[model samples]
Target chain A: MRIVASALVLSIPILTAAEAARGETLTVTLSHHQVRITSTYTGAELAVFGVIGRDGATAPRSGDYDLVVTARGPRANTVLREKRPFGPVWLNDAQVKFYDLPVTMAVLSSRPLDEIADVDLRRRYAVGLDTTRASNIAPPGAAVREEEFREALIRLKTQSNLYVQDERGVSFIAENVFRATVPLPATAPPGAYEVEAALFRGGVRLAVTQTSFEVTKTGLEQFLAREARERGLLYGAAASALALVFGWLATVVFRRD
Target chain B: MEFYLPIAEMPVHVGLVLAMSAAVGFISGMFGIGGGFLMTPLLIFIGIPPAVAVASVAPQIAAASTTGVLAHWRRRALDLRLGLVLLAGGVVGTLLGVLFFNAMRRVGRLEPIITLSYAALLGTIGGFMLVESVRAVLRARNGAVVDPRRRPRPRWFGLPFRMRFPQSKVHMSVIPPLAVAAAVGFVGAVLGIGGGFLVVPALIYLFRIPTAVVVGTSLFQILFTAIAATLFHAATNHSVDLILAMLLMFGGVFGAQFGAQAGKSLKGDSFRLLLALILLATAARFVLDMVVEPREPFSIMLSEVLP
Candidate 1:
């Protein structure tokens, strides 16, 4: 309560004391812009900080505000396969291909998304898991029963903690200041991650802001991954040579026998 | 401790990898072969991508065979001429194997084909070895002469381009050894194995090579073929994980030394019987996996499908 009172007092800049709230905007920042994945990287938690700014003389809102934070990783093509029993063995029978699906995604909101906004608004804004699924773009001539495959994909990703949703992941520390926490798993690929913060009041979106961060490999992890991808023949030969050395070293150690 | 594999892009427990490889190494050492056939399947079971598992095991197989190859070289127990001839054909076969592997992977049927192949090949070999070893055991129990080395040569032994293998004390067409090694090498590359088991039997029974040089010659060929396969997989598939291979090699080499010591006490017929049973058990496991319905019938192929 003290923090909210202080925030209100601080916003009274006096220049437009009688003006109605107008040109409301969100100022967003992140705890870290560069996430480095090293050999010991298990996971990381990122913090999103934002402030709701409006005209200096804007009147106080009539109701509490809502915030939703969404983070999405780099996109890639994905395939979902279904197996069926054939003769005495299970075989891959059906498959669906989704183009440019985010490798990792999470939706965090101050309250249940449905309470904050209606279904059409949430779907239009792609604010939650269901909306995210709806946003997926499948190739033309995709398999029938694609909803089953899409649901399965989301389920599997959720099981692996790749796709996440939390109803109470964001909280307003001050009346106009909010913070959201995004947890990143070790399996998160290295790429640009987009973070979107949206502000709402009375089920109406007031302001939206966007920011991005990068996940990158560092040190030995980066070096090895680069070599394997760019210098395949050399890396392979080196691996074979290393194995031979280990074998020879073993023989020498056991030669006395 | 856990370490991340760059190529496979996953984390694996170091202790688990070492323990699994050591156990497979022990079995391979006791049987005088590279243990890739066992290690590759075990790797996939532990959640490593099948393509990465198959490619990385190639280096491990080469390393395991190096021990036998060097020992045989030092003792002058292997036929260099025959080994080179087999290796020449093995190179051609390895190339074809890599091509086939890439084609199957693109079609997304690589895992099923690999599983089916292992089941059929292991089952047949195990069945044959079981009957032969059981007969040998019974003959020894009855105090009968156990030697069964004398056998008639095949009709194709007289094919053109004959070569005299002075060390093996046999004169046969080079075509036979070349063809046999090519087939074994093809299977070895595709399955990420050393093919020592296949080669040793072919040399002894099909080519009528003396048992004295069979193991050494087989190891010589396997070492080169595995190296070739490793190179091909690394260059073409880009799936070989050097870190994973190194971890496997460290555990396998150390375990092999201890296994060789333990093997000295077992009788030859008992050893053969034990190996046959192990092979049969492995084959049965693959068959069971294929026939049983998976709890989750839907699986995601975590690869670039469009790009």
Candidate 2:
């Protein structure tokens, strides 16, 4: 009886040890301004068996798992807090080499998704958020800009590594990498704003992320108008007068012929 | 100074708008026709709201149309009786057309209707012109007068209000001209055009009006229709884009003059063929738009904000 009891006691530790060795592990650190993760427990992994899936499937291959990730909220001790799973990837096995691993934890930034661009057709085509403005946004008595926004977008596209388009001047923006800082104008309408965010990995979509910001009318609209009017009113008026004079001159000059 | 369009974060430059305005102006100049056909489509393509495009084209059309009328007058092309008859019908048509336009808005079907109509109109005009031109060229090659002059039956002679056209040497019912003018006016209201294209062709083909008389009467009716359109857009939609219109008009008047001069050099067949090509191209673009699914989630639904 004593022998059997001792055997049972011995079996307890061995069975318990096997069950406890589930390989749930997470490690994080930084190298060369990039975060590196070493992991065994892949409960947070983005893919499985070369297919887009959850980490619950199987442990990822031991390598540098380059993934599309973002961090928002706050900073952590030498790392970002709330390190959650993020991906629809930018780099994969092809680009990011396995830096040395049995490691699986992906090191990522706390930097939130940043909008690279926004465009306005000027206030001429819009009224305080009217729906018809959805199709055409021309405000009353506003100087119609002939092709100004398109030209500006074309130029901006050339200068910055960005793509530009508009949904009837409702929204104009470019989609880029995860960690980025977008340029905003001084006259930006202020409100709790949501930006459309999409993530691409190796030219394929990985995930779409959204970020919010407080966009407020920074009083720049009024200032811009004052300036635009001061600049344009005179110029338009002058050009018109000149056209009449030129028309008269052309008539007179061609009279002899 | 900076300008902000609603969806964009940054303000746009006035200079850029001017460049676009110039492009519209160049088109107006290239074609003696009001560039409204180009303007409205181009505006929508570039992302101006539909209402805005319709509203803004008004002032610009007004200015450009005036210049055209003046130029045609100088050429001694104005036909008083024909122009007056067409104008009478055009005014009534424009008023009625506005009601239809509003009703379409109430039903939220304006854009689709307009786009489809535009494409259809342009496609028919272009196709007709191409066939007619080819036939004319073939007849010339065969050394034959293409149309054997069998006296066309006097379809309009017996109708009420027969009117004399000194220039055309025909006396026809005013009914046909009036009906044509009214229909064109309706198109103008819906499409934000002066309806000169619609008017000119019908006068030639349906009524057997001379090309010169057609041109004169078309312009005369266009003037009144454009004036009505301007007032309607302003009072109802309040969509008049004054600055934008002014900027575009600045280039439009001069461009129209140049286009008129250029049109002068082309033979009748050549002019018709070119017009046909333009119309066909415009029609194809609209067809493509309708057939191809939009990338965005929402399709526009139109409704009248005013009765």
Candidate 3:
């Protein structure tokens, strides 16, 4: 399942429409369009190959090019909780709801994100772990400590391997060709993931393009998950019956009578 | 080997899960009890979601109880009438427990509530068992016999709806057994235990059920209650991972046979003492977790309001 998506260079932020019309265009080819998760599925490395093409009027650059490939999983609502000391114990005290949170996110770049772009630019483009934004739906009259929660969310996600970063994952193979390896951990949630590639030179964005892939459960994993979600009652009954059979069989096999 | 759990949405080391279940199963088999009290927490500790851990263990508990239930039924050691009454109350309790579990999850307080409940229940029950077993051991050493017939009846014995259990040769108010079973069922459903440890003592001491039928009757109730709990968890929470449960059931059933063989050599009081210590140790672990400042003060969860 190779999916090669070539995009016409689009003007994004600093890049002008006229410049994008004649400047570099980004084309990306994914090793797999769909990652199927079976019982034995562990983790996968998705190879992203890209070519930087220039139109006739485009000027050649003296310096090398920088590429960043980011893959963001499906958005979901998330809760962040902070534990506070209470009566000799700590418990979850404060919480904030974050809407449209990415279940899994990975950043694969030619260089450290900080070196590629300044903090403000990175934040604007969502080029790194800290730059990804998930809006908090604060309750009315509540003063939300959003920065702390956001940092905590990123930290937790990183710990779980759901959020990842590879500073030198992208490598230039030729003058106009580059490749990036997106490491998807086994814990990555199954859903549609948007993969974006951005081309930069001397801290100035030249082009941006996006592609999509899906992570899906296959075979028994697919069947069971679907049954559990769609026919919960029947799934539960089946589980009980299965357990009973196991129990009965155990007794029979071990029977000393 | 690693296996991905669909409902849990995580990959677990197959060997680790199996060994854990086997260890817990061995203890349960040695003590003639359901091992869910130990299993759910272990699953959570190994990074399975708390709700998933609790729900998935329900079927495992049912499977573990089945062997005892069948054996007791064949021997006619179980009081079917009493077991029915307990199951009736247990069904109600399991329903309420599932509803409460859902509500707690929505509020993001499910983890705290489950931890607190385990600490409290395990601590109290373990302490009682420890003291009783110690006294029993001392009495045995002194060659003293405690007469059960001379024991004073509790005040609650006068409650309404008296019923006769011919197998156990006991006549008592049905309300007591109903209340006890309901409490056990509610705790079991929420905690993912069969509640055999709690039921055995309550039936023996509270209702004066004969020791001969107590284990059999309690196993009967536990088996059905666990079935109900498993059904509710699967249907409502959708957190029961069938693969994980299957692993647990296989390990538990296989390990129990070996454990039963070893248990035959230990004296009853000493065995009870060992079981009590295990319970206390588990309770202490929960307490320690609660009181200790976590390395990471913040946690994240999927919000109930999914987009």
Candidate 4:
């Protein structure tokens, strides 16, 4: 009761002054305990980092701050609020910092690897008409580039919701490397969705950020299907048969013996 | 590799290793072969390094073999005097084998050697033992039995170190048995097998030890060979990985015990023939691999599977 009374008396004088506030710096990171990769090193990931602290000029540790961080978009919003329960992360005596982390806050997809290219069909679909002029401007074999936007057209055709990074009190290390990905499941909603980055400290909301990306899923399946027409169905059947035999033998000897 | 884990990993479960050891124990006991013959390869196929698998198998081999020997001893099947002679040779041979193993590692060719050895050795031995046992089985079916009441042969009367073996009922020199023991030890060293297979053959064909005692006596010597191998690997090369090895051994011991019990009901020659056939088949596969140029040399061929 005495400690509460003293804090109340101290805050009363400060509350009346109503001074403007600033920002606070807190370091954030993640620590992964163990990681394993498949025999085929196709999948990889980026680590996410989150830091949380308060501005001494205005809001203290217990005070709320109207933090705004320019991130990809809002889906990162969910990750931004409240410190979670005990995880792989380690905390010091102060409980205000995170250390030597593992995965960063981004995941980049890998491409379809091919050992042999019998026919050059990696390029199949062209978005938009190239406005017709660019196709004429190029050499006979080359398809000219179109400066006109194709995303708006895609948006009308499919419900496109691109994820953008925007949040309060979250700074993201932007990964600008564009990736060529083939969708695995067609059920995946093709639209623009917000990619949010969040920060939580000591079980409290501290910061967040968001980003946006357009979902492009067309002609992806054709890449796998292209040149098989020349090989015919017999080879595919034989290959599938061999694969089944191999898989069976592998399971026989290799299953948790 | 620097050995890892026992008390290190979280949620420490020695129970898993212990249970596995028991299984390995059972199988090895039943088969009358140090399951290490199978353990190392099986572990590696599952991604455990060969060194760790071998190291772990040693301890479990000792444990399970002890149990097997105890049971056999109770049945008066084991010959302690024979085991002692074999141990002396085995300890020496194990040291040499560990040395060679290290040297092979330095050359980066242990895989080929190991692969070739397992495929060739087991397949050949299994095949030969199977054929021989089949013949004996056929003869027994025909009711052609050797007279058991005949006086003991004194063929080794002229040989040195002549001594009486009341169980064997022979007044013969100890030199042949010692030589056989030493030769088996040498092979066991190079192959990383417990030498039980070789010992059984020696007892049957050369030393004329009774077929009934072959399993028990070979197992007796195997315990010693395993101990020596474990110590040698531990002391000299530090090749024995206690953690991984123990994990494999744990499973192996239990498997061996159950195998031993199962083996108990089988006829002598039939059991021998089956064991030999397994050896031959596995060995033949190894040899075939060496001779048959696989379509893809770089294929992901698993040597063992995960437990």
Candidate 5:
């Protein structure tokens, strides 16, 4: 009986030690939960702050930690077209449709994505814009190369300030803590956005923490958008009437004596 | 002077936009046409998206046409009977135009198609107008009374459905006027213009309507066509930016007042010559854009996913 009791005590410490090495814990805080788009809305900056610790401990060692932060807008289907010379004129030669792609994406990492993760890992996690390919569907019998279209899509998105990648965008302020600031351009579509902070150790994912926020129109913009989507006929009628009235008023005001 | 455009979701310099609209409006007022051809391209160049630029300019065309119509009404220059027939054809053309526009948009080919068509159409029309106006100016300088009515008639003038337009004192087949107006309306809807520039010339040269009646009749038809265009854009594409339209109309109306006063100072031949030159210049720019290789050869557009 005594031997059995000693065995139980020995196994308890071993189990606790195993649990300690199981995974890291992550917590995230954002500057704002909702972005209000008003008349003067040009663009906005969001500061994402997070901390990583192992098994509920206060802080993890600096050398053992690597962080990657990504912020992505709502997923939507997108079509990318490539223009090529057809005879003497330029025409749309090829197109690729990407399903469930983020309209805007920003990736920030402690180091370059290739340096931090292997090809499979990067592809799985979509660590960089180049590595991200979410179900690109091409037309049947299209002779165009898929890789060329995908690269062109990324290039176009980057030029529009929609897809961004910064090798050193994330910085460690102290051991186990990191922060990043993402800039959303004026052209960013209004929708829900997800911000993810992933903790890694030696090229392996430890833990991932996620938070979400919303971007929405307000005031006159909100009313106009609702009218357009919901009561389209009424909106059209009103717009036409307003135009007519303005035209008549202008004529009357500027009429010669 | 920056003002936020709620619908466009961007901030623009109030002074710059107002001045630009005013300048275009002045030209429209002097020409007695909707300035949409100039307005849409200029708006796009100033960073407005092509869809939004095309849709938003419809209301401005409506407003400018209304002003022109009122002025012509005061002068008793409109042929109401002829205007009605042109508008009847315009309605059908606009409906078809909107459908074609949406189909092109579905294939993500709207921008390039619009640009290419603009280049071709503007080049042809501007070239013809330049030659005609230059000849008119030279004839006036030589003190020769060149009567437009004495010009050789087109072969198609003898087609069926002959009708009498008493106001302009002409008897011709109705098909030519209707077909011409329909063609102009189609281009107008696609390009976000009032079709006034095209319609005015067709009335004067093709249908041989008097110059005095042509401007008023063109304005009358454009007012209705623009109204249809505004409704179609709003209901179908939801792309009509009311804030942008209102700002442009505000400047356009005021500028038309000054343009009318300025028109009084210039001779008819000189005025036509100046307009022709401007048209040629605008068309040249479009041609240059088409022939030149773009820096970026790829474009991104939103795709409609099956629900």
Candidate 6:
């Protein structure tokens, strides 16, 4: 309650400041900035609320307000491979290397992205799933049909629920206030995520705002990840010893009288 | 009911994982075999990544094999000298296998190679088991008796470095047994199995070990091989998921006990027939997967970020 109240308080000042400046601006506030992963963690739904403050003189019709929100997980290199028939068996044939691709991505828009902005603008802002693929480059010397590989990556990621785009995800709660829910799947890796919200008028981007949050493992997950990465040899030895002890214990406890 | 696995980075139903492991454990206990051939595929079918599934299953096999070894030890069904020879060969073979595994992964050929190898290996082994067991069953029904002493001598008997195995009643070159053990260990490391099914048959037919000691000695070797595999996979690939292994082992330990008790009442021929059917079924599944069209032809893997 206190966090929400404080966020609302902070949002008001930004809203009034934008009105005084007589220009279009966006102010975004997230419900929570830190997501903790625990033993019981399945998934999480994060609420993103923002206000699009615009000068009264340039205010569009009530129904013309457009807001698009995008959340991207940490960037990393990825390999995408396609299996093709070889003789009688299928083998991986075509491969593509993508650099600096977001591990997870979620895009939410009040309306269809095409209706809000043109193709060029959408591509520039990565406002839609199709446009997001345009930014990924194929590795040199690889005969990678960029279009096919990019589509495959999108399809696979979408099936895993790591990449999502919802046309009606964002909703206008008031004339200038909007909110959207971003669903993070259980398979999402821990990382820093950047949430970007953009405001547009007449197919022109007016103002954009970005905020970041962190997803971190806690408790057993934290300890295990740390051990596996930092002290790998020790972790392996401990794991083997634990298994040995457990097996011995089970034999002792379950022995027939 | 669901628990998040840290290394696998996924949430799986506790009951589902336990039930699957228990089923595999029961089969392993009844047959005196390590259950990785069944368990690894089941784990992949249930949405765990194949790499993670393969690596994590090693520790579970180690635990189950230890229990099996203890039980056999109590019955005095073990030949320590022969087992040590196999273990020495197994350690060397596993090191080579781990290097091969890492190399295949680096070239992005690991998934396809692993799948194809499973299909080929399972198909041949299952086919042989099914045929041999059926022949044994038929011969028993017909009351045909054959004297073991009259059988033709194996050609490998003339090799150098002769060693006597008093428990198995065999006097032969150590080269054949060591070579067989090394080959089985290599496959075991690559396939994430204890190789008990393979080793048991090799001991009985190749080394001509007594049937009583074969199971115990195979388990003893498997325990060490599995431990080596788990450590190598963790140190090199960091693919060993301890939480997943523990969950599987938790159910396996109890399940093996019950399975062992139940196996006492089963007839030998019928037991062999049942195991043969299971092996065939698992092999058939892999063959079908290879021949059939996949729903998605493409897969994505995150590459490590260079420092």
lDDT of 6 at B98: 68
For residue A40, what is the lDDT in candidate 3? 78
User: How would you encode candidate 2's per-residue C-alpha lDDT over B1-307 as one tens digit per residue?
Assistant: 3234321222334565555655654444334455677777766665455776776666565555555555556666667788888888888887888798888878763566576777787789779977886776677678866431134846666698777888666678889888887887777677656767666656656766655445545655555555556556555554554545555565565655555555556655555567667777877876775565444322222322111
Candidate maximizing TM-score: 6
Query: Per-prediction interface RMSD?
Result: 2.1, 19.5, 1.9, 25.2, 2.7, 2.0
Model 5 iRMS (Å) reads: 2.7
Backbone clash pairs for candidate 5 read: none
- Please list, in the order the candidates appear, how each scores on TM-score for chain B only: 0.84, 0.81, 0.82, 0.75, 0.86, 0.84
- Candidate 3 per-residue C-alpha lDDT over B1-307 given as tens digits, one digit per residue, 9 for 90 to 100: 9899988877899999989988876666555567777898899889898888988888887876676666556657689999999888887776687677777778875777677887898889889878987898889889986534348877676788888889988777889888887887777667556777777667765777765466568767767767877888888888889999999998876676556556556765676677778878878987998899999988886544233
Single out the weakest 10-residue window by summed lDDT for candidate 6 chain B.
Answer: B144-153
Query: What ordering of candidates by TM-score runs from best to worst?
Result: 6, 3, 1, 5, 2, 4
Query: Compared with the true structure, what per-residue lDDT tens digits does model 5 show for residues A1-257?
Result: 00111112122222322354545677777777788877767778787777665664445456767788999987879888777785566776677888888888999998888778887998888778888766887876543588877888888888878899988988887676677877787777788999988887789987887888887888888898788767767887887788778778987887776
Worst 10 residues of 3 chain A by lDDT: A8-17
For model 4, the stretches where C-alpha displacement exceeds 4 angstroms are: A1-28, A31-47, A50-257, B1-24, B95-125, B146-158, B236-253, B288-307
Report per-candidate DockQ: 0.49, 0.04, 0.57, 0.02, 0.35, 0.57
CAPRI level of candidate 6:
medium
Which regions of candidate 1 fall more than 4 Å away from where they truly are? A1-24, A54-63, A133-142, B75-77, B97-118, B151-171, B189-194, B204-213, B261-266, B305-307
Tens digit of lDDT per residue, candidate 1, span B112-221? 77879878988898888789889989998999866445556677779999989898888889998888778877776675566777776567557777654665677777
Docking class of 5: acceptable
Would you give me the overall lDDT of model 2?
0.45
Q: Judging by TM-score, tell me the better candidate of 1 and 6.
A: 6
Report the C-alpha lDDT of model 1 over A1-257, residue by residue, as the tens digit: 00111223334333332233575677767777888776666668887877777675567762478899999988888777778898889887777767778888989999999999999999888888877653344445444577778888888889888899999998877777778888887777788999999988888998897999998888887888888889999998898898789878887988863
Q: In candidate 2, which residue ranges exceed 4 Å CA deviation?
A: A1-110, A113-182, A185-257, B1-32, B107-118, B141-154, B297-307
| Positional deviation of residue B129's Cα in model 6 after best superposition, in angstroms | 3.1
What's the lDDT for residue A8 in model 1?
Answer: 36
